[model samples]
Target chain A: MAGKQQQRLPREVRERQMIDAAVRVFSQVGYHTASVEEIAGAAGISKPMVYIYLGSKERLFTACIHREADRVVETVRAAVHPDEPPELGLWSGLRVFFRFVADNRDSWTVLYQHARTQGEPFAKEVRAARNRVIAEITAMVVAGTRMPGGERIVSERDAEILARIAIGAADSLSDWLLEHPDESPDSLVDRVTDLALVGVERYNTGDLPPS
Target chain B: MAGKQQQRLPREVRERQMIDAAVRVFSQVGYHTASVEEIAGAAGISKPMVYIYLGSKERLFTACIHREADRVVETVRAAVHPDEPPELGLWSGLRVFFRFVADNRDSWTVLYQHARTQGEPFAKEVRAARNRVIAEITAMVVAGTRMPGGERIVSERDAEILARIAIGAADSLSDWLLEHPDESPDSLVDRVTDLALVGVERYNTGDLPPS
Candidate 1:
């Protein structure tokens, strides 16, 4: 016990611990319902130490949002290859997104549910994160329209609309999946990709080969 | 003056006055933010009379939600045909949806923003109203698919997914449009319809159609 106690954690390790705690707390109680003392308790640290590590509650909440938002964005980005056809790229990106959410329900809840209801600044952070996700989806749609040999290219406005629909489907499905945890990400992603591709297909030639 | 002061209002006249007053108060201060007193004052009635007419705050809120939800659902339902192909039905439905929101911004906001965030029983009411919209959209998707088109036929699961996506996109766009009041519903609906049709066309055909 004494030896274990002496093995101090690294700075990065401690910072991650605090953020993980913050995410869990925020997810459960929401922003207004959560308190600094509760977060400190959840982190297995003293209130003063938590204050020293993360500063104010607002900063701590933002830190959690940033970290989770970055993870979500990075996962989606890494899953897709820009060089690939838009349909396949979008398929991969969606698979990564569902998998990430399935693995991190707490973080998703914290980011989607708790943050949006916090009002003002917190709402803005949530919107920014949401905008990033939508933007990534939009890029994939744009790429699909610009594929070589593709005809009847989608207009920018139309592409944006498609992007919004795709994002909405993904989001609403994610919320539904949370309630029905048994559904596989592969199945969900497969259906969504099929549906999304259908939406953009009319804008391109119906018989065009995949790029 | 004596005749007007002594006259008793008809039931329909009083009910209309209460609803009009309620919409104004609820829209301005939100359901939770708006007080019964304010609503009564806006209606030019005493607090006791207001309570006698509408019961408690919860009852009043439910009344408001019921009226607005019915109006929205009825408007969209009238625009969509269960027999028509899904794409055309969805396009018509979307136009009606945007029109309803555009025409009754405050009522829509009351149902969507204020009630949705309050959680629990109220959210369920909103969800049911939302499901009606989704159900109509789902029916359209189902109608679009053919029996011989068995493999590509719209599954109930997929139809639900499509409905969710369509509804979410329309709802989010409406929310965004509320802030940018200069945007006309006709132009926005046209773009959204095009985008939705693109997806539907893609679903109908495996890939992009040849030009």
Candidate 2:
């Protein structure tokens, strides 16, 4: 019965378990210091099994990056509804993104901080993920530019620029979010919104007193 | 007479020449593929002398990163005048920054794109340079928040957030600038400013029609 139960698990399920363990181990020990044995042990599988399943440590790390990047993209996409306004969609996406990072700090560290500095293949993977996110956001921004009256006030180039700003701000702020553990993701969003409002008001009114 | 002239050159001048050559080589061939012998040849020095001056290829790359980072920071700082309003100061700094990256494409590639992905000692240097830039921009934002009436509309925290946005946007847009050779730095800045103006206009009037 036990042997049958072990054999019943699918390859996909086993791979998921291995990746989940790999992320935690990689995040904690880092890429160079982490070993396949430890990862296998964390996954409750044999070392040779890990090698057979993922091929090698490098490949395993790449898998982890892809999985985490997909999860983040999906999370942000899920939070944004097409029926909503672009700004609201952006706000929702940002909130969820912060929450995702906060909730999965280990994944964030491994996927972002570690993978980026690991060089070569891993850095390429990270760049690919970033480009994917950028493309999605650019599409959203373009869609937002068209008004209910069908008037497009913003150009496609401008939409791309705004999307860059939004993504960049979100990326930078996520680092800030991780550093400031006491701040909730929602609170950080509020702070950013408030600051933008104040900046807009100041810019328009030209009321900035000379310091 | 030639030997005497070469010997008369100061250590600082020799080191500078080596670094200038190293940046060119590193940027062209990357860190691993670049050879110290090649750098020495480019600098009009012997390979043995290159080793004696810069210790190793790693240290030579480090020197290149430092010098380039310093040049960028200095260029941006010089463009921003203390008497100018914060927005104008930011605009000037951004303009100079884009120009610098546009003007020094190889340096940008070596300092930013390459140094970041080369792993440890090099990655640390890149982070340090980034932190320095962030700190300077944060100070500028904080100063901007204080009005001539001595009233502060934005908090220090908010100021830091704005600085992050500025730096992140600049960093991301610089990549876009590099990718599109036809776009001038001035044109990019104008597009960004115009987008901000339109965004501000739309946000204030709540005139965004639901699509």
Best by lDDT: 2
Q: How close is candidate 1 to the true structure, as a TM-score?
A: 0.77
State the lDDT of candidate 1 residue by residue for A54-74, as single tens digits.
Answer: 898998898898899899899
Measured with C-alpha atoms, the lDDT of residue A22 in candidate 1 is 88
What TM-score does prediction 2 earn? 0.92
lDDT of 2 by residue, A116-199 (tens): 887879999988988888888778877877888987877777778777778878888898888889999988888888876775
Quote the lDDT for A7 in model 1: 54
TM-score of each: 0.77, 0.92
DockQ score of the complex predicted as candidate 2: 0.47
The runs of at least 3 residues in candidate 1 whose Cα sits more than 4 Å from the true structure, single-residue gaps closed, are A1-13, A25-35, A55-59, A117-121, A139-155, A193-211, B1-16, B29-33, B55-59, B118-122, B139-152, B179-182, B196-211
Give the worst 10-residue stretch by lDDT in candidate 2 chain A. A202-211
lDDT scores of the candidates, listed in order: 0.74, 0.85
Cα shift from native, residue A166, model 1 (Å): 2.2
- Candidate 1: how large is its RMSD? 6.7
